[model samples]
Target: MLTKKKVIISIAVLVVLMTGVMLLGNQEGAAEAENKQVTIEAVNNKVYVMVQQVNFIEKAAEIEFKASLEASEEGIVSSKVGGKVVQILFEEGEYIHQGEPLVKLEEKEAGNNLRAAESQLSAAQASLTSAEVNLESEQGNFERLKVLFDHNGIAKVELEKAEIAVKVAKANVEALKANVLTAQVNVESLTDSLAYTTISAPISGMMDEKSVSLGQNVDSGTILGKVKNISPINAVIEVKQTNLEDIKVGQKAKVTIGEREPLVYEGTLKSINGSADPSSRVFKGKIQLDNPDQALKPGSFAKAEIVNDQKVEIATVPLAALAGNEDSCYVYVNDQGIARKRSVIIGETEENVVVIKSGVQKGESVICTNVTTLQDGDVIEVVAE
Candidate 1:
């Protein structure tokens, strides 16, 4: 009975030793696997990214906006007197100069009235000459009578009658002169009416419209056509209230027209409205461009870029570096091989680059690629261009 109890106790001891050895081996295996996993993670954790150094550059700020082209000078051709359109001297799209006759009207009636006025003036002038000769004779007789009275050779009553006769002759001459002046005025008035029979251009420009045809009788103040001076045209633009302060007259601007292949024109800021438009609530701006060829037509759509004279030093980065929308923009900057996401305030965008107003310093490396996949604190390997 003693031997059987000892054998059972030895068997229990061997089984406990084997279980301890197995537990030790499993623990060693788990430690080795954990160390290998840590080494793999340390080697493959870094991401490859492209970075650009932020640069400070001096550049003039530009404002871009939509614009509409218009002629600098526009004239409305109209008639001052009613008449029949005898001859049309200019056609639509014809170039004309100031004071150039554009339409001719029948001049028979106006010519006749002018001739009558001239005849009346001639008759009145001849009558005045005869009256002046008569007054001279009367004056000579008065002088002779005065001498006779002084020498007591004539009666006082006779001398008085001679003086009164001279005075009456002078009065008659003055009345005739008044008549001559009235006739001269009439002649001048009639001459102006005769000249009005021809309609002339008020300004130098191209005729853009025609309202009267030959043989068409038009009343006074009738619109004949429209003339527009297209050289040195105006490009009108609406400026927002926020950007009003940055622009002023005399600034340089570039105007572009067409979409497929744009035509660029150099211009200057001509005017800015003092008050905002009632409907758009924006200020109207005008840019003047020299169009010697008249290639810029009126009412054409255009785009304008106004460059400010004041230059500013600003930090810039590639547009690809921006990670968020316009309202919320961010960029990843490499800080000693570690990517740190930073929120940035952006300004104007020029081509593929953007102006960084804040949150990034000059000469700092900004991650341009793999921005979306980068976290707040990411291990990064900057690659060459």
Candidate 2:
């Protein structure tokens, strides 16, 4: 009976030990599965991306706007006298200089009047010379008569008559002199009238709008043509009130024209309007460009980039790092290995880089690659470039 009781106790103890071992194994398996699941989740959540530190650079701020090219100077061509246009000296679209003759009118009537005045002046001068000679003879006669009267050789009446004759001769000579002077003035008037028959350019520039033709009649102050000085042309731009503070007179600017293989010209901000426009609330500005080649034409579309003289320190990032359109720009910045979406104010773009006006600090790591795939509070693994 004692042997049988001991065998039953031994089996019970072995069964209890086996149950404990099985329970421990099951617990270990569950722990391992939980750990594996956690590892998978961590791997799935982490994103691998390339990043670059934001750089602060000191550079001049630039503002760009669409502009129109215009002539710096313009002149209206007109005539001062009225006559029939006998000749047109220049054609439309011709380049002319100031005071260069452009048209000619009939001057036959003026020439005839001038010749008649000249003939009158010659006759008056001849009559004046004859009158002066007669006055000298009359004076001699009066002196001789006075000497005879002093010696009782001639009467006082004879002396008085001689004096009267001298006075008459002097009056005649004075009248002839007056007539000569009037004739001379008439000649000058006719000469000026003849000169007015020719019309000339008022300014040196490209001429256009030839209104008068050969045999066409024109009156004084008639619109003949227009001359526009295109060299050193002006690029007119409208600037908002907010931007006007940054721009100043004599600031450097760059102008671009055309699209396919565009042409660039360097210029300066020549002027700005004192007040803004009532309707648009913008100020008009002018950028003067030296166009010696005449490559830029007036009324052509252009773009002006004004560079401010003040240099500012600005944060910059790669173009790829930026997301969203120009209206609302944002970037993904890495904060302690986590991607944080940050909204930023966009500015001018340089080569392969963009200026960040706000929302990012210098030396902060910005995710450049895989930015679109990132979300706020995402775990990121920064990779080398």
Candidate 3:
């Protein structure tokens, strides 16, 4: 009976020892697995990313204004003389230079009148010359008669007749001289009028409008056509009365059509109105754009993005790096190997760039790639941009 009790006690003690050893082994295995998982997570958190340093940028705001484009210089071409449009020399949209002939008016009649005036001038001049010649001969004859009469070689009647002839010749010559001067003035007037029959371009430009055609009769001061310069186009815009102070001559602007990406242009503010518009209560402004190739057409709809002279220094980051909802916009910045979250206030977004209005410092590196996969404290690998 004592042997049986001893064996039972030993068996119970052995069972207790085996259970304790198994429990200790299980605890050690669980601890090792936890440590392995932690190591794996540390390795997986290190993700490759591209980063860019934050830079202080000059802040610019776009002030949109609707405008119409026009030629830098435009004018109406008109005829100076009343005549028939016998010949149309230029077509609409034709490029021309200053003093270039654009239209011809009744050249036949004008030429005839000019020639007639020239003939009259020649006849009057010839008459004047013949009278002068006769006067000289009569003066010589009168002098001879006076000398003969004084020497008692001729009668007083002969000397008096010669003197009368000379006086009549002198009077004829004076009348012819007056006629010559009158003819000369008439000739000049006709010549000037004849030249005016041919209309000429007043400025170097392209013909935008044509009102006269062949066989068309047009009176003086009649509209013939319109011409406009090609280079350096102008965009005339209207600004609100309250925003007039933000616009001024010499300010730079970006010009564009509505959603026409390929047609973007650079323009400069050229003029501002001296007074606000009374009816619309808006102010007039002008921006000039360079069109060296004459690609942009006048009278087109355009807009000007005028930037004010006022600028503020702000930090910038890549647009791709921004994350989170509108209520909580943030960026990931690399501090050593860990990503630090920064809440930001955004300003203007220009293409792939965004202005960080606040919550960013210059010279700080910002994680630009793998932004969505990054957490507030995740590790990052900065790669070349």
Among these predictions, the greatest lDDT belongs to 1
Q: Residues 80-162, candidate 1, lDDT per residue (tens digit)?
A: 87888899899888889999999988889889999999999999999999999999999999999999999999999999998
Between prediction 1 and prediction 2, the one with superior TM-score is 1
Query: Candidate 3: which stretches are off by over 4 Å?
Result: 1-57, 138-174, 239-241, 275-283, 312-351, 354-385
lDDT (0 to 1) per candidate: 0.91, 0.88, 0.86
| Model 3 per-residue lDDT tens digits across residues 1-385 | 9999999999999999999999999999999999999999888868888998998866666688888988888877898888888778788888788888888888787789889999999999999999999999999999988999999999999999999999999999999999999999989988988999878888888898788778888888998888899688888899887787777789899888654243678889999888888888777888999888777788888877898877767788889889987677899988997899999987556899988878888778888988887888988888765
Clash counts for the predictions, in order? 0, 0, 0
Compared with the true structure, model 1 gives a TM-score of 0.66
TM-score of 3: 0.61
lDDT, candidate 3, residue 300? 86
Top TM-score model: 1
Model 2 TM-score relative to the real fold: 0.63
**Model 2 / residue 221 / CA error / Å:** 1.5
Least accurate stretch of 10 residues (summed lDDT) in model 3?
255-264
